[model samples]
Target: MSGSETIGSYLNRLAAGRPTPGGGATGALQAAQGAALLGMAARFTTGEGYEDQADRMERIASRSEEIIRRALKVSDDDQEAFAAVAESYKLPGETADEEADRSEAIQRALLGAVEPPRELTRIAAEVIEMCAEIVGVVNPNVLSDVAAAAESARAAASTAIVTLEINIRAVDDEGTRDELRRDVERGEVAVATAATVTRRVRDDLAR
Candidate 1:
């Protein structure tokens, strides 16, 4: 979607019958929102005595911007891959040769569907870690925003991981499955990081 598009419109499209902008896309969109919140918090922290940390904040902001863009594209890629998988299933398979071709196409499509969510899980985890760092450095007034960002990142990472896990099951290649399993393990660590960060945020809010 163009940067000019409204979020409401996107949500409406998501709710529509079309499957292009599905759960994986939503996960990416949520992470982008989290990234935007993190950038907003970082923007508030870049001044006065914070000059030393300003550079780090700028770097985070830049990377978050990139991630946001990539996530949106991944959202589109995920749907295209999904469509490929669905269409592959429809390929004619009455004959032996047709069955072989259809099977090959489906397997390739499954791999295609597996990739975007895996990348999304990885990036969302990084965004979550960035939130953990920002929670300490951001102005107290915007602490709540950082907290929201962390929560969103956690949800986004978790969602993408679920999508990844689901698609991984259709993949018959043991090597690819093992690699994705490792990615899931790493994503679980990211979820733990987000939980720890959120716990600190909760503590701060209580105090």
Candidate 2:
């Protein structure tokens, strides 16, 4: 999941039987797409009739550039994290000691894997917030893009929650599980905000 890979190439790899570039990576990309859309809308919210909102749009566009970079990095990191989990499962376990070691390794890998999607959920929340900010303020010509951004963020957060939940199940530590559950809750909040932003955009369009 190199950032430089073409969309077709990434899709081809994702469609393969491999474990990496799976749901987590896809979720990260969705967040990135949402952020990119927000950045575009913000950029269009400048000059002439938008004088009062220029500064706010500029700030959003700047922050969105940063979020897009972070999301792409998370996307790549997710593939590597999932690959580590897959490799941990391949560890030899013919004896009791080996089995214990293998189990420990798998648990450690699963714990490590949660961070990427957690970051993704955070990114989704940020994107959704930006969408909310620009929903009515952005250029009316591209107002629908705000809803599109919110929907993408919603999808990303939902997918990230699922990915994190699957990894959390294999993690035996109660404390860690509780922490991951909190993150899932946060992602759910972000999903709710995304829905709100989308609904607001829809109401605006209906008017």
Reference-based lDDT, each prediction:
0.85, 0.90
Model 2 lDDT tens row, 1-207: 566889999999999988878899999899999999999999998999999998899999999899989999999999998889899999999999999999999989998899998898889999998888778678988888989989998999999899879877888999988988988998999999988888887888899
Model 1 misplaced regions, further than 4 Å:
none
Measured by lDDT, the strongest candidate is: 2
Candidate 1: give its CA RMSD in angstroms. 1.3
Off by over 4 Å in 2: none
Checking candidate 2 for backbone clashes, the offending pairs are: none
lDDT of 1 by residue, 1-207 (tens): 547879899878888999677888788888888888888888888888689898889998888889888878877788788889999999999999999999999999998888888888888888888988888877888888888888888888888778878877889999999988888887788888988888888899899
